[model samples]
Target: MSSAQVALLPGVQQFLDRQHGLFIDGAQQAAQSEKRLTVWDPATGKAIATTADANAADVDRAVMSAWRAFVSRSWAGRTPAERERILLRFADLVEQNGEELAQLETLEQGKSINISRAFEVGCTLNWMRYTAGLTTKISGRTLDVSIPFPPGARYQAWTKKEPVGVVAGIVPWNFPLMIGMWKVMPALAAGCSIVIKPSETTPLTLLRVAELAIEAGVPEGIFNVVTGSGTECGAALTSHPHVAKVSFTGSTATGKQIARVAADRLTRVTLELGGKNPAIVLKDADPAWVIEGLMTGSFLNQGQVCAASSRIYIEAPLFDTLVSGFEQAVKSLQVGPGMLETTQINPVVSQAHCAKVAAYLDEARKQNAELIAGNVGPDAQGFYIPPTLVINPDANLRLTREEVFGPVVNLVRVTDGEEALRLANDSDFGLTASVWTRDLTQALNYTDRLQAGTVWVNSHTLIDANLPFGGMKQSGTGRDFGPDWLNDWCETKSVCVRY
Candidate 1:
């Protein structure tokens, strides 16, 4: 390979340095127990590296370290402004190393470097910077009241946002760096110590982030990383007696499990789980714009996004036009190595995920759903599944009901605008949805009853650091971005003063 192509691959030394093992007390160390996990590059089906996979024993050490740091004067005694400065520096470090982190994410997550650089790493920087500013701004308001029995008596009561103790942040594989930042940045900004458990498949970038965070002046043990499986280390973190909170971003099934374990000790939790989001296209919508929006919304990140518009409802009047445009858009997408700058759609995360998506396609075909474009996959070599589109898909079909988390979209034709809205809300998952209509009145009317946390009009899948992101029903609870995100890791305590 040429120098240019070598530059595209992950720097071996950087990868080894970052992917060493559990990061605790400001140092990288092996797991307490002898467990290991093999990381892979899904784009080429190659083994990237092996790292220490922490179990319950490792989780105990991490949580204890974090707890000690949280209560110690070294971290908890620091003023909010001081914490803000360190976080701002950390954000700058992330931006300075954005290219390297983007390459690691592309190598591990099987996402295009274009998408990783433009979206994932960019979003991480924005979140870190945004949260850095929010640290000093987190405050409570005072309330005035008079005693009913004693007219002369008065009450002065106010609330303070205090940091919860040790927080365990278990992030998913998709958008690993961005989601990991979402879980830890707000906690750190709120003056809480965190033990992050990055998904085993995509731990390299997150481990790199930990090093940068410490180098940026975050106190030792204030931010730790434990790379391991969810069943062991993740469960231990969530159920540990000392850990004050658990914030997880993964499947609904796993979220339920975590909630059950957290409930045992009555620990606080914020779960950002799965989504089978929908996109509703009304009759008055612009076909060109709506089609483009749907294509990007459903197929972006190879459709590995939790809030990706997987289920789409189009008005019958413009269904044919939208489908035709969508087919052309998918056909025009470039699928290749993630390091390639021009590739739009890369391989799925792993062979198992590719197989699951292929099964859905096969089942959809057996049930008589029409394949609109792209269903070519079944290879064990690279785990590549072409962006797939299914027309007139049944609502009960697995492809429509389940979260495929791949580049597969199901299109359903509705009678009208009202029917479009009705069909869109039929699913159990309601993370996000989009309305593509030129009529302002129709867009506003539809937006009011979308039943999802976010409703994008004339566009789709556009996220910002200032907006709160999460789901309503099965999509999961609690927000990930904005000032509100800080509330998830901190508890509000009311204090009263009488003079």
Candidate 2:
């Protein structure tokens, strides 16, 4: 498509034309260092914009600004109702600019624009509303206490939830606006100031979000963003003394690094990391349903989701039907730029990622694994890797075990549910899994037996505002949903008084 033919949100080009900077204290601040990261449009593998690359100094500046805000009680000082009002306005602003945010998400992150609108913009509004509503409802409990510390002394005890102070949220590249809100809303609802570091590759939308936050009357420095690489800015932000909490969503290895950095400060940390999730198809399941479920499950966001179910286990009896149906379904998906409403499989974020994912598929062929369906599309232009299905995968291959984070699927035949459970549970990652069956007993059995954080009966990737979404074990700790999830962003303070 020619530049003249391509359509964009009216605000997109105007926004991208400016030199992107680190967002701090409700303004765009130039990076102290001269380094800048080129923002790539994965669909065309073209440089769309350039943003300042933050170093440790910039991270320190952002974190310190957040600390000053927290200490000043600029945001946390607001009454629950006032805070709620601000957050509601923030959500409203986000909705008002929905077209532009969704466009930036699709342009930078390479998910379908329809998905960017529905899942990204649509879900974010609902989530923000839900989170905002919880603001006034946050409360404390008074407990009856019997104190023997002193003669004739009556004791009263209570526990209250307090914001955990400045939070440092490290978001992954996929679902930038949606997941960034996942981290931001809860922290904001809990009355904590935050400094978020977006994935350098997809930092544009969040920068715009920061600007909108200020427009919504959020106090300066309460919501800051540092755009840079993991080694420099990320390490500094996670290790900063003033940041009371660190919430990261990324690879397990990087999660561990963040954990280690936060551990030094004894800062609270929440990690939602990598997964090699499993999807099981039972004998009683409809092959068509399995195919449809796996379409989103295995290939949503080009399989970049941490909870994406790539390793599929189908019952032996239903193997041929499910496999053949799935193969056709995979092949039928439209692979193209995310902006098109018809496109299903957009590129995998970048060419480097394309190569990394393709390497795994190449290994599958080297091991004589059956290529059921899929093709890494045209190499010269876009970073497109359409839905790929590989059968006859060996248990020992890296392709079988590692988190591919791409459009690659591996199907295995399981003799029974027990076999499925055994094979699925044998993974280092336990982010999420699903079992498709009509038998309530069989599905319920796998629900407990499956070694994953979130288990679905017949669905996958269907997230809600109330779901306590987090990973178990290597998938990482701390959830990001519900009132309980909001609590993770706060600290419990017990108050005792003698009267």
Candidate 3:
């Protein structure tokens, strides 16, 4: 499209015009060393922003700020009702600034403007509101004790839930804004001060949101954002002695490292990690409906979603028809820059990621997988790859077993629901899976048997703030969303008194 004809999202240009910095002590500050990372516009494969590259010194400063805030009770000392008010106000500010945040996310992260608006900003707002409601509900129960202290003395026992002091949250490049919200909001609601380490690749949206948070009347040092390479800042934040809890969302390898570090300190940890999720289409599933579910499960957000269904298992009876339908849909997608309103498929996060996804295709051909759709080629100057589907790649191949984390999927044929179930559970990842079928009995049976944290029946990747979302096994430990997340940030203390 010509420059004259290009339709840009509101505030896209305005966000691109400014220089962003890190958020610490409720203010925007530059890196102490005057270093910056060149953030890429993956859509155009151009440098759009220079983000402050926080070093160990910066991480220490943010952690100290959070510790002071926690000790002083700037946020944690407030009554739950007051915290709720501030958080609800923060949600309001997020809603008010939704357009700018969405546009900024689309520019930096290279996701569609529609998705940035709906999922990045809109869903974040809902999650914030949901968490805000949980603030006043963080309570403990009174218990009766069967003990006597000093001859027939009455005893009372109760428990109290307290914030785990300072929290460190590390988010990934994909879904930066949404995942950042996932980390910070619940911690803040629980009255714990936080230091956020966003992916160096996409730090703009998090920085801006932290600014909005302060504007919503959150006290200083309650929420801080540090931007830099994971090796330096992320390692420093997770290893810092002052951080009482660590909440990280990224690769399983990184999550393991964080776990090891946090374990040394005995710090509370919650990790939402990687997935090579499967989508199983049972024999009773309709081919047309199943194809739509497959597309959404496999390719939403250009297939960068961790819970995105990358491995597809189809019952033998429905294999031919479902595969043909999926191929047609994949071929019809429009791949281009997110700035164009007409584009359906956007570029992957970077040139490096694009190459990683491309290599999988080369290996698939060598392994004799049937390439049903997509082509590996550079689209203009952007890091674009067409939505791809391969049929029956060897189950043991890297493309089949590992997370491609791009717009690519593998289709496998299974004889029955039992075979499909066996193949689906045959993986190191147990993040999520989807079972498409009209048979309610079969769906329930598979739901009980699937090793994943969440199994969708006739749907995929549908998330709600009320429902818990996380992975089992190597996918990661703990959960996000729902009331369970609130509990993870708090420590239960039991008190006993004799009268």
| C-alpha lDDT of all candidate models, in order | 0.85, 0.88, 0.87
Stretches > 4 Å off in candidate 3: 1-14, 375-379
Better of 1 and 2 by TM-score: 2
Residue lDDT tens for model 1, 120-156: 7887887888998988888888987665646566678
* Runs off by more than 4 Å, candidate 2: 1-6, 375-380
Residue 87 displacement (Å), model 3: 1.1
Question: How displaced is residue 175 in candidate 2, in Å?
Answer: 0.8
How many pairs collide in each candidate, listed in order? 0, 0, 0
By summed lDDT, the worst window of 10 consecutive residues in model 1 runs over: 1-10
Q: What lDDT score goes with residue 128 in model 2?
A: 93
Q: What is the lDDT of residue 299 in candidate 2?
A: 86
Residue range 203-260, candidate 2, lDDT tens digits: 9999999999999999999999999998888888888888899999999999998888
TM-scores for candidates 1 onward, in order = 0.95, 0.97, 0.97
Ten contiguous residues minimizing lDDT sum, candidate 2 = 372-381
Q: Which has the higher TM-score value, candidate number 1 or candidate number 3?
A: 3
Ten-residue stretch with the least lDDT total in model 3: 1-10
The residue-level lDDT of candidate 3 at 138 comes to 92
Top TM-score model: 2
* RMSD (CA, Å), each prediction: 2.2, 1.7, 1.7
